[model samples]
Target: MEWIIGIGVCAVLVVIFTIVTYNKLVSLKNRFQNAFAQIDVQLTRRYDLIPNLVETAKAYMTHERETLEAVIAARNQASSGLRKAAADPGNPEAMKALAVAEQGLGGMLGRFMALSESYPQLQASENMKQLSEELSSTENRVAFARQAYNDAVMTYNVKREQFPANIVASQFRFTAAALLEIEDQAKRQVPKVSFS
Candidate 1:
């Protein structure tokens, strides 16, 4: 009868809907992983450049040896952070440590540049200029990558927390991912830089 056919159609539609929802969840999960991978790529580049930047500064400004050492130490700490993050990307502590290390490294870089400013010849050196430019580019890339990763995390987290999606996410063990947090309270406050 017509009632039997209607029932069959409803059941088929439900099955199709479930399959589509499951596939969408899988796609979102993959996007989250891809975003994290992008961040990892940029961080690796930044780490590789840190040593060269420190060495270049050391050669130009011998008196800034302490600053260079600090940078190196921060780099080591950050490297450890990267390892921890890689081992467990969901670990919030690793993210915090990495953020602190990054801030420390940034402060050391500022000091290195300030110290370099004292030496006009060093500033004008071809090698120094190239290194400075490279570091600046790396910083920009890091910022871009961070933004991309955060955006992806936001998308995934939202999807996983939604009503029906939450059910699917829980079944798949898709937990929320942590963002790279700013650890230093002082650094949390934004400083205004005036061009005037």
Candidate 2:
């Protein structure tokens, strides 16, 4: 009779542990999902600002139509990437594609800004100044959102990998989430200076 009681108690404890572990994992995953949503919102705002910036610059940059067109193309590619990443924020491949697209867009925008420097009238336009300010503000917001998302992902991944949680996570098929890192585009090599 004592052995029967012991077996019942052990079974109860095992069930309780499994339930708790599953709940914790679910909570962690949801947190990261929410974080990703914040990033999406900010990125959408950033993408929206791109067109206004391009349009304002258009009034002054008549001869630089090709550069303007390239910027638009990069923006479109980045937008497409956002859709894919939003569909599966934790997927490694989706996140990588988004990062690459963003990097390309950044490079294009950098070139656009450099070219605009040659046109004093464009640089001094009130509309251009306003759009530039908004873009700069949006960039800051994106950086913050990305940091929050990465932090949440790190927490979720650690929890999923820990001892007993690992057992439950595997059984329940909890996959590791990838980090979203949007790095700056690589710069061109500097020319060597020769003094003969």
Candidate 3:
């Protein structure tokens, strides 16, 4: 009789452990999803701002059609890539494509602003100034979003690998998320800013 009672208690303990572990995994997964959603919101805000900036720059820089078009194309590609990444957050290829598209957009945006230097009148224009400010603000927001997403991924991944959590994670297929990479090689090579 005592042997049967012992077996029954062990079974109940195993069930309780499994339930707790499963709930923790689910909570971590939801946190990761919430992080990705935050990034998407910032990216959408940036996409909306890009066209206004291109139009403003276009007015003073009539000869910059190629640059403007490249910006537009890159923006479209990035938007699509972001959508794809959101659907499959575990795919590294989608993340890489999104990063590349964003870099292309950044390059075109830099060219647009550099050309703006040629026309001081345009640079001084109220519309251009406002658009420039808006772009800067959006960039800051995107950086914050990336940081937030990384933080959430880090937390989730830590939970997935530790001790008993590892047993649960392996059984349920909880994979770690990829971190966002910084884009510009030129910025890393040298002091990109020149006061002269």
Candidate 4:
């Protein structure tokens, strides 16, 4: 009779442990997802600002059609990549695609800015100045959001990989999360937007 009671108690404890681990994994997953959402908001804001900047420059850069078009194309690709990553923020392939697309966009924007410097009228335009300020602000916000997301992902991943928690994670099919890192060395630099 005592052995029966001991068995029952052990079983209950095992169940409780499993439940706790599962709940923790879920909570961490949710936290990282929320972090990704913050990044999404900032990137969305950045994407929205691109077209306005392009339009403002279009007036002053009549001969720079190819560069303008390239910028728009890169923006569209980056937008698509953002949608994919937002759907599953830490999926390896999706995050990789987002990073590449972002790199392309950054390159195009840099070229556009360098060209814009040639047009004195475009540099002095009030609309261009305002857009540059907003883009710079959005870039800072994105950097913060990305750091928060990476931190959350690292925490969640470490928790998921821990001994007893790893057992529960595998049982529950909790996948590993990927970090959002820039792939290219040159692309690591954010475009310098100066309207001064």
Q: Which candidate is the best by lDDT?
A: 4
User: Global CA lDDT of candidate 4, please?
Assistant: 0.94
Each candidate: what lDDT?
0.76, 0.92, 0.82, 0.94
**What TM-scores do the predictions have?**
0.81, 0.92, 0.89, 0.92
Pairs clashing in candidate 4?
Answer: none
Tens-place lDDT per residue, model 4, 6-109, is 99999999999999999999999999999999999999999999999999999999999999999999999999999999999889899999999998998898
Alpha carbon lDDT of residue 162, candidate 3? Answer: 93
Q: Assess candidate 3 and give its lDDT.
A: 0.82
- lDDT string for model 1 (1-196, tens) is 9999999999998778667767887777677667767777877887888788777667678877787788788778877887777666545687777778777777776777787799787888887888788888987887887777677777877888898878777877877877775444555788989999
Q: How are the candidates ranked when ordered by TM-score, highest leading?
A: 4, 2, 3, 1
For model 2 the TM-score comes to: 0.92
Ranking by lDDT: 4, 2, 3, 1
Error of 1 at 93 (Å): 3.3
Model 2 pairs whose backbones collide = none
